[model samples]
Target: MKTNKIIVGLFYLPMFGLLSCNPQEETTPQYKTIQQAIFASGHMEQEDEYIISATADGTIREFSIREGDYISKGQLLVRIDSDVSNTQLQEARVVYNDAKQNSSANAPQLEQIKSQIDQSKTQLNLDKINYQRYADLRKKNSVSQLEYEKAELQYKASQSSLQVLEKSYKQAQDALQLNADRSLQQVKTQQAILNDYSIQADKDGIVLEVLKKKGELVRKGEVIAKIGSGKNILKLFIAEDDIAKLSIGQEAIVQMNNYPDTTFTASITKILPAFDEAAQSFTVEAAFVNPPQLLLSGTQLQANIKQQGTKKVLVIPSAAVIRGKYVELKNGEEKEIKIGQKSGNWVEVKQGLTEKDIILLPKGKSKEEGVAKPGGE
Candidate 1:
């Protein structure tokens, strides 16, 4: 009987050794209400950012405005040295004045033509009177036909001379008027070119950067400064694979790198349809619900956009999930699971597991004994 009892105890001793060797933490899944979300990182950008560029090639003579300066619409930001343009403008003004004077009715050339017209009118009236008198005399046969014929010839010659003079006056006037108009247009063109030397702000904004300093030469279309509308907006880049899951009006929680302790709420305001090759992602824009008191441009941030629906699902410790696909049971069996939603340290188990099923956490993973209660962080 003693030998039979010793063999039984030896058989049970190995079973005890196996139980003691298992050191994994054990926990069970619990029902938790959670919302699905996608994560993305980006930075804050000022709305309506514009690059101020030089319209013409010249050296920047005056650049009083610096970065962070507030500017209003049409405010002069920089003045370029335009000596050549100024000289051309002066010459244009002189030519315009000369043409304007010549086109005027009181010009010397017009005055001379007016005097000739007056003299021609006087001669025409005298010739007409003499011709009419001679015709009356010829009707009464008091004058010879040769005398009346000479008077009529003189009157026709005077009329022809006056007509020629009047035509000459009109032609001269028109030519001068045309010249004046052409000169005036040239003056306006020069004036516009001179205006290009002065760069002005197109809208109210803050100067974000001053790319060109005083005395720096800038070519046409070269960037001189950068301005922003001062209104803050989130410019997020989402992964191409995750972009399709996002939509306008989705809620996003933002944590700025500068304000690490605080989190802000925002809503998706815009989403670009095309993928950005440079960023390797799709662009998304958001508006803050209640923005911070002071916001700076280009502030780095991270955000999580919550999906539309929320439901109660069975969830286990994220540490217990193996390779994001499987979890180990307390009985030393590996169980594969289909996950649905994920929050900080918790993962939702959609299938292959129940609330009654207990899981073993892997080595170095945080292990909570028993079942974890559903609660918000």
Candidate 2:
């Protein structure tokens, strides 16, 4: 038994030494299959907001609303101090009245002038008879030729005076007629000017902002206030590349910054015809069908629009897929992948990896010289 033990010890001692010298090999950096959440982050915005501006130039006499005030359609937003204008209007009215009273302005005033002419004619007839009697006396030599000439001249002077009076009366009547016509036009012009005293809202909405202070001067046709159509909509901006995937009536999930947990239901409402030149994105308008109770104008929001067409897809963290199809594999292998339908967070994986294989997701690129590998971290 002692000899057998000795032989067993000798056999095991070398094996132990060999095993002690050889440590377990460190695990090599390897690519891993990790589920990564693809994310597209943006904020929420209110779709329906109206901005108001000033219309007519004058000091604001009264302002009916402030920021965040609810107002109705045709509500008087602001009033300008139109005291001077009103006074002018009143003066215009007086002038108009005076013009109306001017009898010469009316054709009937011509009758008054005609009556004066008839009276003058009667005086001329009497003077002519007197002149004729004087002329007969001069023929009997009781009156001299010089006296006859003087009487004839006096009668002719009366006739000329009547004609001149009639002409003057006709001119006065014509002037009165012109004055009446002018008065009527003046009244309308004054009314139109007076109407500018008050500024009214064009639509039903809350006041988002008050641009002008009370008593601020403004010009005609200048925009004073803005109103948003009460559509209760949300404006969402989808990237130009992703806009093609969005269509009208497409479902979307809306979230506001103020309310984090709640998700308001919404759908694509309109796609803008023109793209913003500065922002390389399409303007997509969405309607919140069942809007949240806390919703208000100018509320910021975040949107996630899901693209249609569901095919089996391999999705990785968007950070894992960089510069098109290239992604880091679980084996620390950076390889190109075939990509398909892409939406907000998930994209369809057409090629390069299978369901059986796991893809590595990189948190992000490091500023270090070494390439980002699956097991390098």
Candidate 3:
């Protein structure tokens, strides 16, 4: 009985030993196409959208269009209260007209000067004739020397008076011309200011928002409306860590949360040089090559930007690569590896790995657990 018990115990001991030992789980490197991509979250926005602001301060008297309205360049969009501007312009026009009349050849001031000069010329002519007669009488001794001298003095005084009047007239004409020119310039300036009261569209676009309504007081430089150029595009805010992986002209796959089944394709068009402090990310812009039919501005979306094109390379599951620089063998031996491009699920083995190499999964995980299944099954 003792010998039979010992044999049974020995058999059970071997069974326990076999049960305690764990089998080695291994995976081989694969020669497959690997793509390097970066994940980003962003929204859709019009590439040419901009804000329209008031040029002059006034209350909005009328709005020619509303939100979602298509408008053209130079179309009047709003009319501010122009009572003050109109009054100013009218006053300026009156002043300008007065100055213009004064500057004209038939002006009352010029006419008065001409009439005075004509009268002075007539008096001078009479004085000259009298002086000539007085000189003849003095030579013949028919009139006194005092009479001839008085006639000469009268003629000389008349000549001086006429010259003075002509000079004064010319001076008056010059002054009137200067005043007219100044008033005309003021009128032109006033007219320009009045035009500011009528706000017109600077470019052809769709009105997305009307910030100031009728009768609302708008200050100069205040935003009154938001306009969009009617072209829809995607705007993304990529994390600073992932910015280095992106470049212009790379392909991007876009997916919107609202439309789960649909996917859109785009290509990177612009990368802003400055970082957006508010979003804590870098701004990037893309245009759709094959866009969704009903994409609207301000729609939220997620995108995966492919950084590198697909290439046939030695690849392994990300879990099989330890600390990104080495891989563990099935025999518990670690080997240093040089890796290159990496995606979320896999990493490219640039050197120190090949398809023939057998790598171990992390401890306690089975081959099926750590290995990326074939065809992502």
Candidate 4:
């Protein structure tokens, strides 16, 4: 009986030890201020970054600018082989010169027309003199009636011929002028097309990348290079769910992958109005308040944008809330609670609990697991 009693005591001792070592922790709700923020991830980009594309189809004859080169507006960056365009331009030039000469005051066609007019005028004067002589002879009965009528008809015919020649000269002049104007327009159009073969920088910037080789074939509208303003800006991609919380002038806490030990501050400057379908997120642009000494383009980063102002409210460890709806009480009962904003492991308790209420931590969790203390972040 003594040995049995000793065994029973050991068993009870083990049970007592197990009961004393409770796994769940207990804490009372405390009043504190919590700030809300939206999480975003993206990369560093040069401000005003844009792709330079080919305007005419041809093999690249010359690519003058290389990566990391500084360029000015109107600087020629590339020249296409343009053998065909050069030929077309030559043809256009030939037509333009011909048209210009033809439209000049001393054009051969006009000169020939003027010479004909001079000859006609001379013949008209001779015919008028003959007709007058015939009329005077007829009045003196020195010429037959047939002879006078013949001279008068010859004078009238000369007058009609002169009028017709003048009209013909005017029509020919107008047609030549019109043809010259049309040809000149065609020349200008061809010249513009030829200019497209020479690609020039549209803005002052740096060449970030060269996409085409010197001998590569380039199609119209194909990208040839990437360019941007040398200044850097942070481009963040925010999820659709959190995009609505973002606004201009908000503060951002940034951590760049290149600078692991440093944290930077930035202010939101722009929010793209449309959603990015490829990325499945919305883009937000921010500028650093005090940028780093050196910045590399396309640097990956993560950030948190402040969504709203701080608020004073009842708070508790997030682990205490069961499935975001209720919490375990100290007396082994579940009490429903309304939660507002959450920051890390801390949550704001809006209703169904008071500062005096004691809450039990969930299973397999403890205060040491990054749970904020009262009045702490």
- lDDT agreement with native, every candidate: 0.84, 0.63, 0.79, 0.82
Which regions of candidate 1 are displaced past 4 Å?
1-35, 239-244, 272-281, 308-377
Best-to-worst order by TM-score is: 1, 4, 3, 2
Ranking by lDDT: 1, 4, 3, 2
What local lDDT score does residue 254 receive in model 4, on the 0 to 100 scale?
74
RMSD of each: 10.7, 14.5, 12.7, 11.0
Least accurate 10 contiguous residues by lDDT in model 2: 368-377
Compute the lDDT of residue 157 as modeled in candidate 2: 90
TM-score of each: 0.70, 0.54, 0.62, 0.67
Query: After TM-score superposition, what is the CA distance of residue 181 in candidate 3 from its true location, in Å?
Result: 2.9
Candidate 4 Cα errors over 4 Å, as ranges? 1-35, 132-149, 308-377
Candidate 2: clashing residue pairs, number? 34
Candidate 3 lDDT by residue in tens digits, 1-377: 53354346445744665765754445777766756566667888776898878878999998888887999999999888889889999999999899989988899989999999999999999999999999999999999989999999999999999999999899999999999999989998999999888888878988888788988998999999988886787888888988877889998777665554456778999999999999999989998886776766678876768865666877776667676478998678899997654444556787898776778767554423332221101
Stretches of candidate 2 off by over 4 Å are 1-51, 103-112, 117-175, 215-224, 278-280, 309-377
Candidate 2 lDDT over 65-120, as tens digits, reads 88777777788888887888898889988887777777643446667777778888
- Tens digits of per-residue lDDT for model 4 on 1-377? 53354346445744665777646666777777767667677889997889989999989999899988999999999999888988888898898889888977689998998899989999999999999999999999999999999999999999999998899889888888898899889888888999999999989998888999899998999999998886788999988888888789998877676764456789999999999999999999999888877677888876768765776777787677786479999899999887655555666787899866767887666544543322101
Candidate 4 matches the true fold with a TM-score of 0.67
The positional error of residue 195 in candidate 3, measured at the CA in angstroms, is 2.0
